[model samples]
Target chain A: MRIPVGTAVAAGSIVALAIVPPITEALREPFYLGLCLRLMILAIAAISLNLILGFGNMVSFGHAAYMGIGAYVVGIGAFHAVEDGIDWLANGFLHVPLAIAASSLAALVIGAISIRTRGVYFIMITLAFGQMLYFVGVGLEVYGADDGLSLYMRSDFGDVLDINDNTRFYYLVLALLLATLYGTKRLVASRFGLVIRGARSNERRLAAIGIPVYRYKLVAFTVAGAICGVAGVLLANRTDFVSPDMMHWTRSGDLIIMVVLGGMGTLFGPLYGAAVLVLVEEFLSGVTEHWQIVFGPLLVLVAVYARGGIAGALRALERRRG
Target chain B: MGEPILRLRGLTKRFGGLTATDSVTLDVVEGEVHAVIGPNGAGKTTLVGQISGEIRPDRGRILFAGQSITRGPVHARALLGIARSFQITSVFLDFTVAANVALAVQAHAGHSFRFWRDAASDDALIEPAAEYLGLVGLSDRTDDVAATLSHGERRQLEIAMALATAPRLLLLDEPTAGMGGDESARMIDLLRSFKGRFTILLVEHDMDAVFALADRITVLDSGRILVSGPPDDIRADPAVRQAYLGDGDT
Candidate 1:
């Protein structure tokens, strides 16, 4: 129990991923590689939102907008770079950093406006902003409108680091996800984390105790946006495509579902939730075209039966036993 | 007193037709226990709210430590060493007693930007938190979940947590509200022991505790000051006796 939950989770994931590549390659299974990579990216996205919703008590419904912002970054960058023969520094890396910056900037503005209201209003406003982003993504002609754009080639990390190859791409995505997980763990545990948690527990108490709750929550929101932006980039790279689907409200719901399914507020829970979701998607889809009919009911069950999600329920059980 | 540590001048708050706090003015010297006593509907809690920045006043200025802090928000006021406890025992019930106090310690230990280290493990945050807990007689129950504590004990924990901020002016809003006679007396004794170390602004209805511990008693009726003086002077004031305490009674 003394062991940091974040570190333990990161270690377990790395060890599991290390065994996956060789096993998949020997079995001549290329699709499983994509599935695993997709899970990692989604998990990373879910965890970013978890920092805000779970710990900060900020239920942002527009979280998928960051992911969309990130995808568009790569998509737009690749289009300009490929067509105009722009340099790597100009066309490729340009979009990734810009995406994160845009998302952070957007979060600052949206957070400012949304945090002015409390309870249900906050959730509604965030979802509204996310819908706006989704519509905007659909309207963009440069990125193929509703069709989505694909990268003809991956972002060059230099001559040695081609993202076009599946195995190399998988490792790179893994590294970034781990880094994000580590960063989030550090950010939450810091003095800042304590403040954020205090604000979440009781904003009035925090204010009386000498903390600017609104400011701390806004900063945490921006951090979550930036983190989600990173996840978006990995997601776009893994799929080799970008679409307005990335910013859809349902996508935001998916993120929330993953967070709640794994366990809201628990750092490792998001990863587990993401992994379980992708596996369920694969298994369900293999059975029939309308797997969602089955998946939707299962989610309802999870929500109804487990309000605290898996981790909270497990903790309750442990306490009962002890 | 030379520059009362906290001074409230002409503070008023109106709710539609209801005057929650009428033009109320009060003062607390650097090391005096100034008690405000009033009936249930006399705007006692409202006065505490206006003074603590929870409810902004429609009019009037507040000065803390010789400087006007009328425009300061709750957090800013708290940072300037003003700490207030709730009349209804408010605490971070989900957090452990130590974690609850540690948050107050974290607020004052510079910025909370230090990441990658466990905040609970940091001696800087923990030691001060522990010291305050010990002061409030909560040292043994530091690890206990605050929600599980008895109501009176939770009140003590609130004081300990508030003290962790190293407040210059401690505002206690009915610290003995829900306590039994013995618990209430013990709480009063604890507050009595805290005299001379920090300024206290106590708003309570308990006549025994108020009269016994107060350096100066301020009586409020209909959101206005009925009278304010030393216990002997306040006790004999006929107007106070009529407005608050009926006929020869306290």
Candidate 2:
């Protein structure tokens, strides 16, 4: 198979990650595992946003709301189960599906209204929905309110899987990331994907050609939300906590930044973006407490120099070689 | 004429006090190139918009294939065999020419909700896409990015995409608006090739193309019809000459 250099780079990175637990253990650096896990989960979220923002051209600024909703599903389910001693509600297997379904339903309602509007109106409405959800989270009296709720135990995956173990959990997240990438690649090359991408370029033209572009956009929005929500379940497991701040507007901005910085439309771009963002945050914090002061300029450089982001830059280089 | 295949009755649209299309009534036979011609701001574009469902008329009824479609959505009208090309050369600039046509084909072929297969390689989509591209004489430019094509080629690609939908009526809004002399001629030749095979409602500023291709002509002046008849009749009518063709200028 003739794999593009970028795809190879992405696969190699995943393979390198597969062996990370041993290397980090040898170096006595357990923090690397947590960082890698965070990167994978955030990558999932970025990919979900990419489906709408990059492909469908629906600039939703409230994507993090779904992630927060997904994480909250786990937190609320676990809390209620623990409080009332309900087995089915507490099951991790059930929790993941429930979280995805809840997030998908939320996306359907929000997308139905949000997709009706375009450009800045779309962005504003999405941000409004996000803020509404954020306030709702803060208003929950039983769920620890602003302080957030902690999971008493990590999700149980039966006797075969122990999510508490770092190596196993890392592999699980990695596998899901790979599957998401493959599935998304297929999706974007499918008929549905063409309509989504076509709408991005000329929505009016698409409508004239007998395609109901809005309905396709709604479906894409829902799918992205469902995917991101799955990532939220993983996030709650990784951090063992859920809070309203997770779905704040700034968090949504970060997801947008990830999509743009990595390469908005390319499949593997989000993974690179998530890795770069998390690594930069880690490195900057290590060097100086006020990392944003240094980091803000770096982002501006990427914005100015990389018109198509990193993936676009790589394609340009490939074109030059030929 | 056994109920014109397409009919517009009392179509009226107003932007505040300014009327864009005022009580416009028209009809199109099953297989004839019915041309709409007028000067700038004569509401040709607005009339096309109302027909295509982009601009909802304040008062009107549109019947396509003998069914009232005044409130039909743009896509629904398109699916009912009415395809329109944009006046300002709208297209998917980033896609390849073939891909642009393929997307149009995919839109009408079946449910676009299929998410698992690679549509780019599906022969069901690609085969007809190639056929349509060839029909527009864009077979050579199939792999070229649409944005890289010349202004004339982009317009041709637009027509090809419209044709891929297999529409019964094609609404072309100034398909040769920005073309040079040679490009405009080529477009005329292309449209002529489809004569009598597809119903066309053409809005144009090129008097030569309108006269050459239109079996019948409708003249619009300030959002109202001045005349609608055969091309020779339009040329002879002194009122049309003074208002639109400019008094013996033709």
Candidate 3:
């Protein structure tokens, strides 16, 4: 009946985070809530990437494309509603679900073609598709094109939930993060998860045993894309802006780095990774403008020394204690 | 016994100037251990590859369970009850022994689109996996990581995984290629236990195991079938003796 230490830590962190909104408000520094919101959004995005990269071994360098697509869906929906005075995009329930659906559809199309190729080719193809979408974003003349698009107001929940209140939004973000973490945990341990992990280990063997591995990998890729799309909805609400820069390949690389740093293949590793990477970026940028130069070496050191990332290190410590 | 479970017709594969499998043909009857034996260049592995649908023949039709599956994909062939064990051990090294077998069971059970329940504890997958592991004498090592097993044990584990798929026909490629004398004998006994229950296509370098297990033997030479008949006839054939079994041996 021993609980995995990583799971315990993740649960504890979520509890602490649930209290941070109130504590920060009491201290009159409500800005900290904003930072925590960033952490939650990034964690959701990273967790989605981890579903494929860590478990299925699909090294997609275009994951952020889904996030961008999701954000743009909300942006475009708002654009139609606010500018054109339409009710279709104005509906919260319809638009949010539609955004996720569109993202999953994009992943299915991209993954079908990309999953056929292996190794470096898969990475390059995903990156190429992501860049294609980024260019598309840049080319949207009606939506501010290269500059970006801004929402006049947060998504309308229509009495269901209020996105205007920072506290309510913070709680919504927290709830979604916990749900994603818990759902991903179940997903990676189920029958589907076993097949995906097996494909990563040995695709040929899995096929020999009667598993249609390509179809399974494609499903996983689509699911991950849909989850990241939901994160994008939160991200758009947080910043109230959508841009091609959101889908840039470097953003995908950042998501990959977070998965790698958190100890991939562990359910809670992405959250740990997102927090560390996002917080460190904030901390170092505050100290000096040339934060990347300082941060770059630290990432290399972790990549070199942290064999399995933070969660792996924690597991080792727990073993030593036992 | 009424009809052959597996039939290969005019199977041919050419690698540039060299012919790997040249217009070869064979039949494997139901519920019989059929052994394919050859020297290093006889294309035994290549033949296994073509039948398993990993390698497509330039000109041929593979009939499995009385259907032409020449163009069928590898996994489609597997779903039609053709299970193959690799010459090189290929079980999931990172998974536990039970998990390795459970994956095989899961593949055959139904669509593995299940994403909620914990598969590791599923009685449907676990019970059958344990049974298959027991068949290969690996029931006690269920919880052990597959990579930690000895080389011979891994080979046994590979066979266990293949068996877990519940295939009507088993394609074993050099099942005892790297095993100690004790391990080899144990493998032979385990395979022999399934003799009449499964139609097995075996590729082996070990003549003793082959002679002991094979109901029929096909001797391949230079990418062609030199001789194929009952084990006694194969043993007595002078062509087989010169081509494969050297004169000094028997």
Models, CA RMSD each: 2.5, 1.5, 1.6
* DockQ metric for all predictions: 0.75, 0.92, 0.91
In model 2, which runs have C-alpha deviations exceeding 4 angstroms?
A1-4, B1-3, B247-250
Instruction: Report model 3's TM-score to 2 decimal places.
Output: 0.97
**DockQ ranking, best first:** 2, 3, 1
The local lDDT score (0 to 100) that residue A64 gets in candidate 3 is 97
Q: For candidate 3, lDDT tens digit of each residue in A159-253?
A: 99988888999999989998998898899899999999998999999999999899999999999999999888889889889999999999999
What range of 10 consecutive residues in model 2 chain A has the weakest lDDT sum?
A1-10
Candidate 2 CAPRI classification by DockQ: high
Instruction: Choose the strongest candidate by DockQ.
Output: 2
lDDT of each: 0.85, 0.90, 0.91
What is the C-alpha lDDT profile of model 1 across A214-310, one tens digit per residue?
A: 8888888998898898788778778888899989999999999899898888867788789888999899899998999998888898889987776
Candidate 3: clashing pairs of residues: none
lDDT of 2 by residue, A1-322 (tens): 5666666677788888788889898999989989999999999999999999988889999999999999998898878778887756657798789888999999999999999998999999999999999889999879988888998766777786898888898889988998999999999999999999999988989999999988899999999999999999999989999999999999999999889889989887888888888999999999999998987887898899996887787777767755
- Where does model 3 exceed 4 Å of error? A1-4, B247-250
A-chain TM-score of every model? 0.92, 0.97, 0.97
What range of 10 consecutive residues in model 2 chain B has the weakest lDDT sum?
Answer: B241-250
From the highest lDDT down, the ranking of the candidates is 3, 2, 1
* Error in Å for residue B50 of model 2: 0.5
